[model samples]
Target: MTEQHGSDTGPRYAARRRRGGIVSFVVGLVATLAFFAFFPGMPHVIDWGAVLASLAVGALARAGCRAWMAKEAEKEGKRIGHF
Candidate 1:
């Protein structure tokens, strides 16, 4: 008797989820920035320095997430295949 093996979905699912999340994050970020740019003096206030800081933080966050996922893939014995 042969044992039935399940199809692999981990890589595909993870990639899809990551792509969707990044796209949504980027879109939301752009929208928020545009809103602030257009209505700079609308209310409480808007600080350009804060905007730059947020962008820097986002960059660092993205890098960290990528590094973590890469390590996970390595542990799973998956090759870091080229896009």
Candidate 2:
């Protein structure tokens, strides 16, 4: 059996892996806003600071998850295909 190394992965692959956080951040922001928008008085009822904080938390979680997954894949000698 053969094992693949991280050196074989290109910058594009690294970028692809990192993109998860950015996507999650955008999705989180949109989702948060959407949730607030459902209310009749969104602007007055929603706390903007909390919404921003939630987006930040979501992005950080995504980054952590991506890193863990990459480490596990590397340990298993598995290739993470392009998204």
- Which candidate leads the pack in lDDT? 2
The residue pairs found clashing in candidate 2 are none
Off by over 4 Å in 1: 1-44
Model 2 gets an lDDT of 0.67
lDDT of 2 at 54: 67
Off by over 4 Å in 2: 1-8, 39-44, 75-83
TM-scores of all predicted structures: 0.51, 0.53
Backbone clashes in model 1, listed as residue pairs:
none
- Residues 1-83 of candidate 2: C-alpha lDDT, one tens digit per residue: 64546664556556766776677767776776667767575564557685876677677767776777688767867677643
Q: After superposition, how far is residue 34 of candidate 1 from its true place, in Å?
A: 15
Q: Pick the candidate with the highest TM-score.
A: 2
